[model samples]
Target chain A: MDEMTIIFSAFLNGMGIVFTVPVFSAMMIGIVAGMIVGLIPGLGGLVAHILLIPFALQLGDPLAAIAMLLGVYAVTSQTDSIPAVMLGVPGTAAALATSLDGYPMAKRGEAGRALSASYFASIFGTLVATVIFILFLPLLRALVTKFSSPEFFMMVVLGLVMAASLSGRSQARGLLMAGLGLILSTVGQAPGTGDPRFIGPFLYLWEGVPIIPVLLGLFGVPEIIDLAARNRSIATSAPVKKVSGLWLGMVDCVKDWWLILRCSVIGVVTGFIPGLGGTVAEWMCYANAVASDKDKDSFGKGNVRGIIAPETGTAAHLPGAVIPTVAFGVPGNPPMAVLLGVFVILGVRPGQEMLTYKLDETFMMVNVITVGNIIAAALCLVFQKYLVKLCYVRASLMVPFILAAMVIGAGFSRLSLGDIAFFAGAGIAGYVFKHLDWPRVPLVMGLILGGIAEPYFFASIDRYGISWLYARPIVLVLEVMIIFMLFSTPIKAFAARLWKSGVRSEGSKHGDNT
Target chain B: MAITPENNLQPVDRNQSIAFGRRVDWIVSMIILIIGIAFIIMLQSLPGRATIFPWFITISIVFITATYVYGKYRNKAVWDELYDPDTKDGDEMADTGPAFVLAHRRGVLISLGSFLLVVAMTMVLGPEYAVPLFVFGSLLARKENWILAVLSGIGLWVIIHFVFGDMMRINVPVGFLFGGFN
Candidate 1:
């Protein structure tokens, strides 16, 4: 079939999912489930996606499973924007940057506006990303093929360098955190050599550092401190009325089209990268927004664009991840990979034979993006108001529940007392970093990327010789991009600059009185 | 006690030598470089194909140490804020009330302290015990509502049991204390 035919058929498949078979109802269910799951502290998208996997499997077809999973996936991120905004806790790293602005916005009685803007922006960003991904699939397919080990190694190095440079007060502190992360990741038996660095006698540590608990510590614990330090009265402010307005939200979105579009693109592109996930995408884009804005002071002070960047960056990752799944058969995220495993078990592959010969696989791929995006949008439009009410649920009332969940999630993740210590340690480091105006994301990012990079680095160098990097053009391009990341301000910095200019018009009130 | 913001940084005990802490930083870097270089030397002594990381990391550490040395020539107050509590940026945001100042300071302490508490609690409680205990205690530390704390604890327990035990099948141990009564 021609490219136009594929697009037409995909567009039709999207329409089928959107209008027929109660897409609205599924989205409504998804919105509620997502909000509840996101508020559960450490669980976030991984848990929600894991729980939905069995159900998606029961549907027994690539498209149905994907549609259902996408419904869950899309709303998970949008809802995550909530607790982070109103309560200062985040569902995942994706919501980390959101809390910087969203929580402050909530304290200022614009919680409704913050939630509403993110909800719409999420839908908008996902749609825009979907369009871009669909158009760019062939190019993306061509791009991933050019990545050899040396290039991959170089890419990892660049990300590590950029992460250290962009993060913390100095490169020393950033590298130290990264070094610490590398040590923590080395706890389990080595992936290649089976040498466990620091597991001691515990079998739990034998598998290595647990992702979820580290997540709870890095993101969850600091929020707990913030909540505890604030007196109980911050939660009991008189509720802001006059929040309901569909038309007003639509108008607000129109004015911010450029922002929503740019951030969505950033999120999708980052998602397309193999190891860099939604968390990095959201943060990088949020920072990008701050960097590009002329009004630099408005970012953490409650700019709607700040909230939108992460929510959209993350939401778009659903479709963005789907690209890798359909194009290369590799899952781009933790939970999505689990679902993708089920797909392979049920007989799905993305090799040349699948794309060139298997019409059904191609159809399934198209439906995944177009159909899934609509399902997510319908859910957002219908249930955004109730999710906003969560912002008003008295931050005091929500704290006890969230705090309890965070500890449980951390404790249960590793099945060892040591894991808690790690979480606590990371949290302590996080607190000190925050107070000192240091960035904690680099530490987490280092751990995430470091664990994956070392093995790849050793193997690639041995197989291809040192010169293997120049042989792979895609790898060369990535290496160049990393160089840019090293020298330049992050995409987030640009976004922040643009955001500052917008807020200068509203006046940089320098942190709200509320 | 309050001088102009510019002079607020004048001589805590007089002398720029205090900022030489960066030299300690450089010395630490040098030591790391030496240790790494020694490892490479030992590897070359052994029957192996000489790896790249030791040299790579050692050189990088050396470079950072050199940067630290270069940074040390003057302006000690700028590089080493960790040792100097006398610095003004600690608790002084404009227009923030006394309550905010206190909360912000305590926020720093709580964040730092919670990290330690988790380590201690884990040592005594193990994961299953530690998870619930820490969850409850952390919640209890906030907002002073015991009822919500209990409910959240129950909720956390159920979810962890489901996610870790049933779904992911990652093992979590029960310590000999608390629920270890099993």
Candidate 2:
């Protein structure tokens, strides 16, 4: 079939497949459940994904299974902003940047506005990504294949650089946290030689520290401690403004339409880079917002534009992430890796043939994503006014509930005594980091990317040697881009000044002539 | 650096703040440097390719941390300029009151004790009994109402039993108190 014909037919078939009772119902359930999971601090889509694995395996219909799973995945980044905005605790690492400005806004009684902005920005980002996905489908092979080990290395490097930029106060602390993360990633068995480094006596260490428990420890436990310390509700003020201020938040996003677009592009590009994933996407977008804005001081302090940038980045990356997963059979992120396993269980192979012959299935997944996000966004908008009240509950009352969630969340990793032990240890470390004013985000980025990057670094060294690795055109291009990114701020500042001077000179000349 | 509310640390004369900041920085950096060195030593003992990546990371860590400590020691201005918040001594620095017990030493001991009590109880009594006790103890320590605290404790245990133990089929650890009694 011709490309256009195939696209048309597949999209039509996909609509039929997803709109059915079983599929749509499953999708709705997944969306609602995912939102709940995502709203809870430190519990995110991965937990939801794991919980629904039984359903994914038991369901007979492929479309329904995919719809359910993809629905959960799509909504997580959207709803995860709740805890972020309300408590200054991110539900997931992807939502970390959201909390930068979001929590501040909530403190100022603008929780409604933040939620509304997140909802609108998420929808806009998802829609833009969907369009980008469809337009880029035919070109995905070339796009994905261009990134090999060297390029991947460069991308990881770029992520680390971005993490350093996120160091709100001190580059030293940010770099320190990031370095610690890299060290932590080396805990498991060696990538090449199968030699264990830091497992000690525990067999669990063979797989390295699980990201969930660590994240929960790092972000979740600290918030609980803060709550305990403050001895009050999340919102410090009484008489939080009437909650239906979503329209104002939505208007805020509309005002920063350019920021949304730029951040969405960042999301898409970061998503295309295989190992960087959503964690990096939002941070990079946040960094860009901080870099570009004249009033940089307002960021990390209740700026609506801060919320818009990260939310858009978080939402836009989903479809972009799937492109490489579909076209190259390489999972773009961890959740995508899980979805790839689901695909295999459903008797669908993902490679060039799957991209071509199973175009219908691919489109079905895409449609699920698009529809799922819209539904999630709408539902969030509908319920967020009520949900915003969570900010008002006394921390004393909330602690038991949150503590239960935290303990259970730790157990979700392995259901062993060790998981709790590790969580406590990591929790203490997280507390220390937060206490020391260390930027915690880079530590996480380092942990995630270190595992991916180390293997590529070794492989590139062993196979092609250092010179050949650097000689690759793509590697060279990415390195140049990294350098450019490093200096772009000063370059832009200089250009701005030049333009102003030129304009002033032109005006002066015009005055003389007159 | 611009001081925001997040960095609610009181501003003093720049020199005093710088000295305070440097003292904390030196301690943290030294600790990190020690950790890095320890890791490097540990990795050095590992065999073959396992040593390679870990060694690289530990060395980088050592370099960064050492540099941080040395810089702070040599120039207090750098430390002051980088100072954002002092989370390390957050409890001591926090506003003190009856409600803010967690910021006090007594409250901290209670909180830490409750956590340890939970761990010990879980090992002896399993999650069903231990979790609620821990929750109740913690809430009560935080000065919550007794009835509400006890009720919340029970409610939390029930949820854990039903949700995780039953629905998710997680193997809730049977404790020594059970003595292998199923």
Candidate 3:
């Protein structure tokens, strides 16, 4: 009858799959599996995405496939924060920022409430972002199509500047780290020249360093070192109290609405943008929320807001990423791209009929997301208290298992020794980087986005010739951002300071930003 | 640059250790820089195909790291921790044990040992054999309680053997130790 009715109808139709027996079971299975994966460290989105393929193919129904896949993908960020808040270890890249406050909250006996905040923020963020995505799907698609290499290059420049600007300390070193990341990203395969760089016996090096391994080594290894260094001074705080009210926790979401809202928008926008993905959004939002907070002292030690930022950002991506995927058939994120493969295998076209809302197919797509979220969230609400207890396990008990799992997870992903070796090598390098006062996040981010940027930068060059860089306004804008970052007073100072401090300095503010 | 105690590296022996540790620190970082440079050089030597990004990155990184190493520390920050254990905190927090003893805890060594074991196993038996074996073995080795270790070991075995291997149709290589039995 009207646009509201059409939207409501779409929501209901999309949710109708919950009534089907197979879809219901699939939803539960997906959510539970996602939660488990999210609880374990080093098993990230990439691993989960890989794991979903075989199971997704088995499901066969495009609707069921979408439901299960999205359900698992959606809840991962939420469940991941459980471990982060309680254990001081993150299960995914996005949840990493959560550990800053989450673990601190646990140590302060607010683990339950903090965990509660994470789940609520995620659900609220996803729903709000999803609605916005559906409402603006048409306009967003048209806008993205206007983008060419110049726009993408500008976006990368923007992403680097934003990341640098947001890092908050030692601008010079932060800019240097970002530049180093971009430069390193250019390794292995020169995007413009197709020339290979420092590849060795490690053929995988040809693709540049594996970001996952680096992430594991830099963040995960350093954390392990901290735990080992602080062995006896383990948390003396009382365990978090579990109350009988899900509604109470849900209201906590209302108190921090602005924070969650900002993180959600941040997550959705970054997730929707090609290549920038959840990790950057999570870290940026987490840091921003902390910087903006009046109670900043409780941040890295533990706070509710810290836990919420990254969790909300990551989950918001469920809906945020779906816009580009469903409307344009251009997968905005890795998980969405893999999910598209399942859609293809199931003989369903992603964008054709879904946007118009004419076919039941669009309904099926929505059904999958809604069904999955409901099942996962419902279970989590029921078990939040018990799940929060997992945070108290001693690092000694967890370290061995974590190491085994990381090695196994990395090894299993590609079914190769090379991956494990690469992972270990990355971990050592990461450890060394920490000691040497080098920033590692930019290095990993650069590698992840480098491969993608290369082909596009090259294609654009070949298509319009080298003049294309100057021809486009967007490219010119990006050029300005890059130059601004390089020469900024704060940036130059940080780099010089970092070089001055070297490994024996107080980790100088220079390396801490990103 | 002010050398706040927090910036110091741990695990350096005290006494004559400062000079020796300084030498070790320089050597270790220098060796890493060299390896990185050599990696770049190897990539450069590869025949007429496109792939210069990796080498360029390695070279630049090595150069930067070498420069950082050359200028940063007058001496290794080893004794900085042992003598001044309350390094970072302006407040005095007494150690329950020696600093190095604490750093060399079972949790630390087991994890490091697991990494080396996996690398060695992978070299000897290949990845397929190494992944599951290492997974089960490391968990079994690191956990103090036998029951938990056994359960975790079996749990890991079932998942790797059944879920990943049988159902998912992924092939894990046979270990050299088990080649004769299977």
Candidate 4:
């Protein structure tokens, strides 16, 4: 067949698979299930993906199974904003940025507007990202091949630096926490030699720290503790008299189309890079929004743009994250990593063949992202009135329930008592960090990226020796980016001072002329 | 004394809070420096490749902590900038009133103590018993109505039993006294 004919045929076949009764129905079920799971704080798409793996295997049909899993994966970002906006609690790490402005808006009785804006922004982001995915599918092979161990290591370093610099008020504190996280990540056996480094006596440390329990402790527990301490409902203002701003929220998204587009691009780019997922994407977009706007103070103070930026970025990130997994078997994020495993179990080889003969399967994923997000957003919009009421529940009543749910979620990570102990420790530390102004996100980014980084660093040195640092073109480019990222704040501050002095001198000269 | 939305309580003397914050920072930084130094010492025994990353990170931690401490001491303005109360995004600092401060401390202690107590209770009594007890006790301690607290506890137990126990089929720990769920 000619290339055009093959493309047309693959597209039709993909649509056929999606429209099939079993696949479509399975996807719908997964979408609903994912929305429910996303509403629960700390239980993210990663856990849901793990739980559904066995069921996906039992289903016995590749297309149906893929549809189901992808359905779950794509929609979690849509509904995770619920708890983030209604309460100060993020349903997932990706929703953290949403809570910055979202909860404040809720406090001001605009919960309906915030929730609606989030859902619409997410839907638009997914649609835009799906289009980008399709348009760039042909170039994925070329793009992924350009990266090697040296480049990958640089990317990881860049991610860590960016996260550390952007988070919290003090860049130094963020870097310190990130460094601590990196050291903690080295607790397990070394990647190259398999020799235990810092396990000490506890066998649990040999596997290093599990991310989920630590995440629950770091983010979830501190919020719960604070809520309990405050002794009030999440929103301190009078009860919302009306939940009628859903349409207005959608209107806000439309009004901010340019911002959404820029954020979506940021999302897609970050999501395309391995190890830099929704968390990083959302933060970068939030930072970008703050940087570009004249009214920077409005952010974290109930700015609608803040909610729109992160929501759009994370939503676009879903499809961008899937591209590498489909093309080169390199998963973009943790959930996509799980999806890659599902692909292997279903006897799908991800490579050139996925682009050629198995193209239909890839397109099926695109369909899932498109259709799944629409369904999820529609459902959330319809039921958001009831969802917003969760903000009004007394903290005394909500705290224990949330704590129990968090414990149960952490327990599910390993089904071990050690994890619970670790969770408590992390919670205490998290509370302390929260009390102080240290950023917790960089620490998390460090822990996650450290394990991936070490192996790549070793591989680069082993294969290319020390010259890999300066020899590789991509590595050099990335090194420059990292340097710029590290020094950008100081550089910007100095430039601003210089500009003010120049302006002052110019005004003095004009006065002399006068 | 007037209340503010951000502070949520009558304003306290700013200088006093900054002093307290600086003391807290000193303690925290010193602890981190000590831990980093200890880790660096420990990494000395590991093999070359194994120690490389940890050594770099621990040294960085120590360096950063030292720089932070030194910077704060040399310039009080840096401390002021870093410890600005108004810059806080989420939860604000507790009021500095003596009674409110005591209540805040109590709240922190209670929160931490409850978490540890529940974990300890679970180890002995299993999640089935521990979860309901924690919920009921915390709600009642918060002075919630007795009937509502009891119902809330029961409602949580039912969810745990049905959803987690039955639907998910998680092998929930049965506590040391019970030996096992079996």
**The candidate that achieves the highest TM-score relative to the unseen native structure:** 4
Encode model 4's per-residue lDDT on B10-58: one tens digit a residue.
Answer: 3464455556667777887888788899888888788887877777688
Off by over 4 Å in 2: A1-121, A137-140, A236-372, A481-514, B1-21, B84-126, B140-151, B174-182
Give one digit per residue, the lDDT tens place, for model 4 in A1-514: 7655666677678878888999998898788777755453334565565445445555668889889989999888887787787766675678889999998898888888988899899988987887776667656645556777777677778767766876666777778877877877788889998999777887777778866667678766766665666666434444444445688889999999998999888888887775577888999999988998999999999998999999999999988877766765556765775566456446676656677667888888877887898888898878765654645567677678767766766665556667677788888877777667776767776776677678877898799999998988888998998899778876886799799999999999999999
Error of 2 at A56 (Å): 11
RMSD in order of candidates: 10.3, 8.8, 9.2, 7.0
lDDT values for all models:
0.57, 0.69, 0.58, 0.74
Model 1 residue A97 CA deviation in Å? 13
Residue-level lDDT of model 1, residues A1-514, one tens digit each, is 7765765566565555544454434444444555565444444665555445444444445555555555567667766766666566664667777878877777776766776677777777777876886678556545655555565556556656655664444665566555545445444555555554444566667776665556566655555555445523222333333344445545667787887788878877777654467877888878877887888899998777787767777767666766655554444554444445445435664434444445344544444444444554556556654554544444345554454455555555435565566667666644445544444555555555555566667788789877666876666776787667544643555688789887985575554532
DockQ of 4: 0.35
**Decreasing lDDT order of the candidates:** 4, 2, 3, 1
C-alpha positional error of residue A167 in candidate 4 after TM-score superposition, expressed in Å:
1.6
Proportion of native contacts found in each model?
A: 0.25, 0.30, 0.20, 0.43
Whole-model lDDT for model 4 versus the true structure? 0.74
DockQ values per model: 0.19, 0.27, 0.20, 0.35
Tens digits of per-residue lDDT for model 2 on A1-514? 6666677787788778788898898888789878765554333576566456444444667778778888999899877787677667665667778988988888887888988898888888877887777777767645545666666666666656555544445666777877887888888888888888777887878878676567666766665665554455433344334455678998988889889889888888877764567878898888998999999999989888888888899888887778766664455665665565456446665555556677777887878888898898888777864554555566566666665566665665555666667767777766656554666667766776677668778877787887854688877876886677556654775799799999999999999999
lDDT of 2 at A69: 84
- Candidate 3 lDDT over A1-514, as tens digits, reads 7655666676666566566777667766777777765553334444454455445545646566666777677677666665566556565556667777766666666666677777777777777676666677556545656666656545545544544444423233334455455555554655455556665455566656544444455445544543433433222444345333345456778888888888878878877764456777788778778888998887787666777777777777767777655654445565665554455446555443556644345655545554556556667767765655544455556655555555555554344555656667777755545433344445544444445455555567567877867887767876887677546754676797788768545455556754
Model 3, C-alpha of A377: deviation from truth (Å): 3.3
Sequence-dependent TM-score of model 4: 0.74
